[model samples]
Target: MTRKTLLILLVSMHMIFGPHSFAQQRTQKPPLHAKHWMAITGKPLAATAGAMIFQKGGNAVDAACAMIAATCTMWDTLGWGGETQALIYNPHTRKVVGINALGVAPTGATPEFFRSKGMKYPPEYGPLAAVTPGTPGGILVMLAEFGKLSLKDVLEPAIQMADGYPIEAETANLIEREKERLKQWPYSRQVMLPHLGEKREAPEPGEIFRQPDLAATLRKLVEAEQEALKQGKSRKEAIYAAYDRFYKGDIAREIVRSVQEQGGLFTLEDLARWRVYIEEPVKTDYKGIEVYKLTTWVQGPVMLQTLNILENFDLRAMGYNSARYIHTLYQAMNLAFADRDFYYGDPYFPPAEPVRGLLSKEYARERAKLINMERNDPNIKPGDPYPFQGERNPYLKLLEKWGEQQKGAAKSDSQESARSNEEFEKDFYAGTTSVIAADEEGWVVSVTPSGGWIPAVIAGRTGIGLSQRMQSFVLDEAENPFNVVAPGKRPRATLTPSLALRDGEPYLAFAVQGGDSQDQNLLQFFLNIVEFGMTVQEATEAANFNSFQMRSSFGNHESRPGRILLNEAIPSWVRAELRKMGYEMTFAARTSGPINAILFDRKHGTMWGGSSNHGEDYGIAW
Candidate 1:
């Protein structure tokens, strides 16, 4: 059908049948005719769920929604109940698509108000501070426009896991590591607590911690989705039910009551008025390959800028794991992060008069000039995209400072050397997972699921914890938005999903999960395929290093620090070179990002999916 015809038909059909009424929608089986598609994630269970749907003939979009639900259940790190954000590449329409499932700030909350009242930040991981959760909105929006599977079909795996399943070592470890916080909240205790608190701990590593409440939640969505489709509810209404159950109506009331009892500020209005922003995905050229990124609302766009700079140089010539590659990579990350700090912010609250120019071709090319190809500078400053002012209002805060030689006498901690301050700030970017799916029919999805940081921070009747995203914005009290406060309002997040295409054809479904490492890992994954031209497995296993200090919610909470936590994985030869260049770096214990990606080889007419070997998941098929 022509584009106009299709649009008209969709509108007329919805009107004729009523928005929720769907004779064809209800009785129609999800079209399961794709040649190939597979789900990839850290957990085999999530991968299996998507692969199962693909094996049974589901297309990429159908598989995308299903895999999301499955990952929520099986992956221990995913904030299944948290916000979601996604970027999609569409082959048929020759355009990039996006879904901003990130939640919005409450209407009444404001930064000045918070300052007037008391603290510089919100309550730690409190519900009063949450943005209306958006993952449910994300799922429903994707389904209304692209999904073919019934709600029940897509959610089956999650329901099973919530209702009954054997708990694994990983899940138990997560709970144990964050035990005190969970003990503080009633909901976490009730849902995650063992045997009505009598057991005093979550089920043992291999036992089960069933979630009957979550199961009931999923069941209600399935039934409501079906009925809405029949009664002709608007696509928006049909989608909103998922949101309503969580943020409005009975669920909202319960959530508000629970948090209110705890002295939280969240209310029904915040829940009822929530809306996910739908915007265009950002794009650029790296090594002649077209790279698409999400807006600065996420770190995805900034990552593309990093790749844009790195692509101008040939790192292969420097030798992998050589100090040259490590230094250059670290520099690239620092420059990109400087841009992120100065230029990237909620577009709703622009830093300097709305920087539509931040993502401009001129901007990236100009910033790329800041790199000193030969030597590293211990002293780093912000890059000013604006020429007239050339001002560096955005300073790189020292999150971790490396000791300079008292008299230019640089020192490296040898085998028996005592630990330094660098060693103390070191923490691995762990506890998160990802999912990806794509089919021959041209739909692709990448979701890096996370709720660990927030969900693990608090334990109570609200049943989850607050993500520390608020810390990033707290530094500049002046630029802080009205909703970012001493009391409530969700913080801008680091969890983002990415999609890429070649010649306007769906080419890759990808994700990376770590606090700030999310963007850093994605940049490398893209280069491994687009620049280095490596296969999925080769790209995943390739030894590499990430700059821990470049971008993250790690280490010092109040003051921003400048330190790079280099993975021990970097070869000694590379370390030697970086020292010669005057850059400060430290070794991290396995500080790697979990990457999951799927590729559609149009020339071969086949699709391949797999999790990074840096992780343990695999792509399975019939």
Candidate 2:
């Protein structure tokens, strides 16, 4: 055929077959398909650990525990002393469960104490910023309650890694960058910077990095479990014995001594009193799908609240990533996050969070009515949710004061007052890593574990890095009454893992890294699949916008209203439209994620896995 004839033939075929009919949709990374199980997390090695567990006949919860342990050992944005928050879908109970393993402020970690130190919020790094360790207990409880394997079987990979593992370039580079801070802590300096006075003190990329202390510590837990088992203790009792070893035995003593030596506030009682709570998760329904998140302690509810407000609009009709859709989502997010900044906090604390009112559909409808369809509302303030739940707004005066502060902030948000782009983005997308696991047995688990990241202060001989979650607390009641620094109280954290159910069955389990932006990226990832009909891989790789309108949970807890981030693929016309809507736009080559997710393809009796191409997140399936 002649060239012109061939061209004409192709054009005719295009007209007949439609755009997507010609071939499978192209994605940066291929989606994983599995029949029996799937395991995904922030690191390749950690995902391998989960795969190993699955191959051993372990359930989803078992694999998740293994992956969490391995990631903590590798310092995949966290360490042994960090916090853990998870949402598990139990096949037996047929319900979503929340794992509240977040560390608490130690004794003497009060607002007055921090203010006396001449700080606005708690310090961002060092011993003073440490919270009591929580992950060890969290992992133990999950394994004891839901897993089918022994603690030794689950922790083998992590213990092996703790002995030594070839460090990835990303983590090695981060260590070098933060070496100055690492030097301040003797144990950290000894472990992270082996070369000492060399120009490049951190581990070389792919270098075998060993932590003998950490390996020994892990072995002690196993020893405790074995001792209990030999005594004819039940598996659950054996695991709790290990838990006690970490929290109240020799491990606890070392941790407390090291923390105090480094000028931290940890005490024996703080470690002994901290307990993991396996509570009922909170959920909201949208279009008959129930999405679950941890309660008010973490930022998970923000996504639910956003979904509630968005239920009032026809989001699919707006077209995906179009100016109108982005604008609408941004406005809804700002509104929800405004309530989050003010009201969402530790539910165990007094001046209890009006979560019932905040999550109410009626409150969402009222909040949605305030959205300006034509432009962004930078001055959006927290709505009064108390009345929606049959109560008066006790903090009305404080809310009014906050509103005035918001206006003043908007006015003064000039280039001079704004943080440097580098600094702003750093805190905006801080530490955390996600774990997603599912099995053919109808079990599913999603986890967002974080804290004790690079530049962490390693506690003396224990080799555990202290949690810096104290920075997430506000030092004054006026800033956030429920999140004020206080002993035994948990901070309002940014880590969130999400799960969705349809027709009383598992639909999706997803989570991502990015402080404060965790739910923002997750919301878009969900919409890309449900609203736009993208495959799991396509949804993860899709371009998504970010609104920096919420007060950051890190650093100075500042909010940059009207500032937004967009993927570079956005057309100039869309950018122009958003700018006209009063947005201060910034662009990135990739925006949506490093998200890791497992989609339960119930209709096909298979699992579909997605890991974003931007990071080292990986998955294995069988």
Candidate 3:
């Protein structure tokens, strides 16, 4: 055709399709491909830290440890005092192992203590919400057991960052926004408000924010390790020495003193007694792909249960993001989460969780039958999994009361009963950052480290922000007998990292941020790849919906039954159908993730890395 004719046709096409037509043709970011290794996390610099370790000839575990340390130091939705939960695929053993570094309630943190304070649930912030720090011990243990690099080698990037680094806009602005809360803690105010009394008391974007105290703290751990090595201790022993320094030495003393001084429940013994557990992860087979998640103490197993239930449905036939697909997934997630809120808790605690039964395939089929198919079930209660295990549910009466109370609450029409959308979204998303790393040696690590986010109370001169994870515990046993507040007991947490294997080989290592939404997003991410034929990058950027039917793990532990968050791209007809089905629909421009994932192409012997475009999440491959 002539140039004039082609121009006229292109102009006509542009007018017909609009500008979005071209924009929708490609992803905002490119996918990462690597033959040897790949590193992805919530922050770019943190991912660079992992790359630094990988370039130094360290394994995936070592690189992951570095990324975790760097992210913690940078306060990328977590801090030094935050908890760490990870799933690692050990190539040698060909097994997926769990790293449970979640902190426990400190001394005097019983439900009675909280109830006596006239609080319905634990405080959402401040020292009272603090738990014993666990990330330090978690890092050391993972390094000692599986990593090849020394503690000093793994921590160098974090130490340098702790000493001084250009604070990003997100964190700097967060400090500014939370200045009032930070001001409540003397140490936090002193550190976070570098320009105190100014309009913007927090550090400016791109300012070189230094944390000498945190740098010193990291140096102390390295010093302990070096001294142990000098004393002829093995590398593992030296690492343990550093762990002891943090949990049992001067660091512990400082942490306890700071917390107690601020009216927290932490004690010297609380720090000393906290330990990280390395255990076998729970797994389920969905269409021949084995998906794994951490056990009861976290909401990880909710995804597994959801999968077990979804296994009975042909989701691919429903079409992606169809009203039918969304409703099915939402109902399945609610059923699983209902069980999670009631039954999942610290397995080491006295009242054992009915986890064996909760994970049973037959039990899942039973739960799946509860879905109404055509509409939302706002009153979905925990299933009786105990009978599946040949045991009677001891908390049957409590479960009945819980269901009644939930049903009554759901019937509320009072204006005060409805939470503001902002408040609900805040608690729903909460805070956390995920780390994903994989190497040619067969090591794959997925971590969702959280707590001690912005507005966290800094623990004295240690520069450690205390964890606010105490908010996850229920003050009333009727709410969750297995997750009641008790001294030294782990609260049911939302942090969950995931892994998948095909025919006994590593297939996917992935995790995401957002409190209760973590599993919801992750479940869809998995399905996007496994069932919808999306690439790793496509899945990470896919538009997935969320259900807020289950009780919140943060704030007042409120549940907004039938509330659904949908991506804006969902058709109006789909929204209308969901609304007719009783869903209180909400929309957002992007809804899938900030999910970071690494898909192992075993056949090609390469890794395909994906990081969502929703946030500053990034990845590097080499």
Instruction: Give one digit per residue, the lDDT tens place, for model 1 in 92-196.
Output: 776777777766555555666446656445433545345555666677777767666666677787788777777777667667655667666667666765744
TM-score of 2: 0.96
Residues 1-622, candidate 3, lDDT per residue (tens digit)?
9998897665544322322334444667888999999999989999999999999999999999999999998899899998998999998988889999999998888878988988878999999998889899899999999999999999999999999999999999999999998999899998899999988899999999999899999999999999999999999999999999999999999998988898898888898988999999998899899999999999999999999999889887787787888899999999999999889899878798887899999999998888898989888998899999999999999988988876654454233447787788898899899999999999999999998998898888899988999999987778888999899999999999999999999999999999999999999999888886677888888888998889889987778889999987666667788989999988899998889999988788899999998899999999
After superposing candidate 2 on the true structure, give the runs of residues whose Cα lies further than 4 Å from its correct spot.
Answer: 1-23, 407-418
Q: Best to worst by lDDT, what's the order? A: 2, 3, 1
Q: What is the lDDT of residue 513 in candidate 3?
A: 97
lDDT, model 3, position 308: 95
TM-score (C-alpha) between model 1 and the true structure: 0.81
lDDT of each: 0.58, 0.90, 0.90
Residue 18 lDDT in model 3?
A: 25
Q: Output the lDDT of residue 576, model 2.
A: 89
Extract clashing residue pairs from model 2.
none
Task: Show model 3 residue runs off by greater than 4 Å.
Answer: 1-25, 408-418
* Tens digit of per-residue lDDT, candidate 2, span 1-622: 9998897666544322222334686878889999999999999999999999999999999999999999999999998899999999998989899999999999999889988988878999999888999889999999999999999999999999989999999999999999999999999999999889999999999999999999999999999999999999999999999999999999999999999999999999999999999999899998888999999999999999999999999987777777888999999999999998889888887879998999999999999999999989878988999999999999988888997765554455443346787798898899999999999999899999998988898989999998999999987666677888889999999999999999999999999999998899999999888877777888898888899999889887778889999988676667888999999999999887889998888788999999998799999999
